[model samples]
Target: MVRAFKNTLIIFSSLLFCFAQQEDSLKVGLQSLKKIESDVIIISAEVRSGNLNPTAYRFSVFPRHRPSEVYISRMFFPGDSLQVVLPENILDADSLANIASLEPVGGSFEKSYKLFSKQSDVIDLGIFDVKKKSDIVKLSVVDGQTGSPVLKPTIKIFQLGKVLYQTVLDSSGYGRLRIPIDRNREIPLYALIDTDGRYPLWRGSIEVSQGVSSITLALNSMSLMIGESLFRVRSDLTPFRKGPENGSEILFMLSKDDHIVISRSAGNKLYGRVRLDLHTKKSSNFFHGWIRTKDVEYLETFATDTNHD
Candidate 1:
């Protein structure tokens, strides 16, 4: 009986030692986590808008190059504010200049804020006015050459790199785009029209006015002149030069994947035009300039017919 009692006591002592070690390890781990959390940068903002629901929107913070490391805010109530935590160690100095965006769950519009590099721990952005989707814009897409409706076209409206609205047009090439209004005024946005790869993509900036309801877009068709060939910019920051040579002055810079219509070519240089704005009137809003041949790739070419007017 004495030997049995000693064995039982030894087993109990060993179990107690193991539990104590585990408890110490857990406490160390928690301390390490707390330290890490304290080292992060927190961005807090109160969303202010009529009929605002905290659960219906989300806040995101991420580096431009490292989108996978994006930190999103958790769902909170109306009175509680939204907070986004960005770890300092994981991001470099350049990545510290991140982008903070607020978007709705249904994706009506996205408002982006550029975060400057600051050493502060907590950055409090005062009441952010979230725009509500209260206005409607009617669009009519037609063929540029024929002046007839382009049936069943797909339309996508973009604002700050996010698709604000997407819809397919009806048989009459008409679509009503529902978008957000800011301060009861007009806002500049982008529009992209696709016709199931039948025609070249029509992309241009547009001004959405508060009271204006309708706009028309004309898409150049494949039956047009061969000089109207479409080309897409192959590199970012491609300069639109005033002349064909490298020594020419740059009118503006074009982003990668921007489509342009080539009008002419002068040895290794191409003269093209990009649509700057889409208007309801027939007057053109294109920016015509010269770009290097190496900076763009041929997308499509229409048939050679200069007689049709």
Candidate 2:
């Protein structure tokens, strides 16, 4: 009996020691995790407006031409606050203060407006509303180069930063929309057209009265100087230059999948053009600049090309 009691005590002592070692290791692991987490920092931001609760709005932050963007979540309310923790050097390396509220007023527009962040961590976003209706406007959309009817062209009707209506044109390249205007008062309205969101085709404005009006719009091509060779960006984040040489000024950045049609070549740089629809996918602006030959991978060689293994 004495020997059995001694063996049982030894087994119990060994278990206690093992348990103590495991508890100490677990505590060390938790301490290491806490130290690593301390390095992460989060910034609190708020979106405010006088008329509407800006908390309902979704925000996207990005550069002028880059596709990648930081989406601010909608977890904040009552105070219209949000938490932002950008990647390292993203603020200094690229622009992030530009805020575009992805909220569509009356369910139409989705353009990014510039919002400067202040030291108080607040972003002031203004609100807009549609005005009264007074005019029946008719327009035809056609290809600028070929005069061909652009089928299914998207037309966005906007006034004072607020989108009133969005419609796709009929097969005849024609569409009509009512503009909100008061009689004897000339209110300005804008229209943006695109072909299936692939490219921004045209952007124009109109002055409306209490009467019917008609106009014809010519759609711009995504490619510059058609009948030339076309090429796609070889890599993402390729910079468009102002001249053909190295150290040339960067005009803008292009995505790798975006297509470009070469207009001409000077020295080692190729002059090209592109039309961007921006974030709204409505209004499009034109850009013409130089690109280095080495920066682009050829989709097709020129007609004067010679074979070289």
Candidate 3:
């Protein structure tokens, strides 16, 4: 009985020893993982619009050496200042050259960053602005038919399928875009006007170079050619101006129910021929003039069945 007791105690000691060894091994493994698995880095992202908040945001870090191993980060907000642990392989000396950030705004945006070259761990992605004089691209918008300035049209510039700059035309019908100087000219810089589909889309491209270069975009006429008629929906009498703006000379007056046919556009104004009476079965006399878009409503009829009524 004494020998049997001694044997049982020996087995218990052996089991305890095994458990202790496993516990030590686990501790060592965790320490190694914490030390060598990821590199701690800080990133600060700012929105393009200084005062506006971003919708949803995520940033992606891509290593030049291992293109397949893209590390997409967690949710980020505008003006976010946070630390993130990226894969340690990105620290490899060979991998340091071509790291970049994909879509810092969480939408269709592509910006590159050299992760390894950053002496400090912090990366600040501030508002997109023209950092260098060589990066500025001057753009002008005008009417395709009349050669007048086209105002308030949205412009988007893209390079290699990535958006570089986007803004709306100012009162002067001009927008300044910041783009990297393309030395090779292999990638054509493209621009699109009226991206919202409210008007006919106008596209243009240029072989980009260093320093300021100007491009003129002409928008097609918005005027009704013939037989097309649009109803005026303004509740009160609207003035028809000799020019596009409200301060221009008033050519005539139109009622809410007048039938008008557009002929051309000046800035946001539509130049059209309008009938004096919308309810008249007989042909009515029509007048020609410009009307502001804000004062009237027009139907967007892409495809209509003439016999449906």
Where is model 2 poorest over a 10-residue stretch in terms of lDDT? 103-112
Q: Which stretches of model 2 miss by more than 4 angstroms? A: 1-133, 182-187, 197-200, 222-227, 231-239, 244-247, 250-259, 263-271, 274-288, 291-309
Candidate 1 lDDT over residue span 88-123, tens digit each: 654446634666666655434446465644455877
Q: What TM-score quantifies how close candidate 3 is to the native fold?
A: 0.35
What tens-digit string does per-residue lDDT give for candidate 3 at 259-296?
A: 45565677888887754423321223567788877776
- Per-prediction CA RMSD (Å): 17.2, 21.3, 17.4
* Ranking of predictions according to TM-score: 1, 2, 3
**Clashing residue pairs, backbone N/CA/C < 3 A, model 2:** 132-180, 133-180
User: After aligning candidate 3 to the native by TM-score, how far in Å is the CA of 226 from where it should be?
Assistant: 65
Please report how far candidate 2 places residue 217 from its true position, in Å: 0.6
Q: Candidate 1: lDDT of 77?
A: 52
- lDDT of every predicted structure (CA atoms): 0.73, 0.60, 0.59
TM match of model 2 to true structure: 0.38
Worst 10 residues of 1 by lDDT: 300-309
Evaluate residue 171 in candidate 3 and report its C-alpha lDDT on the 0 to 100 scale. Answer: 71
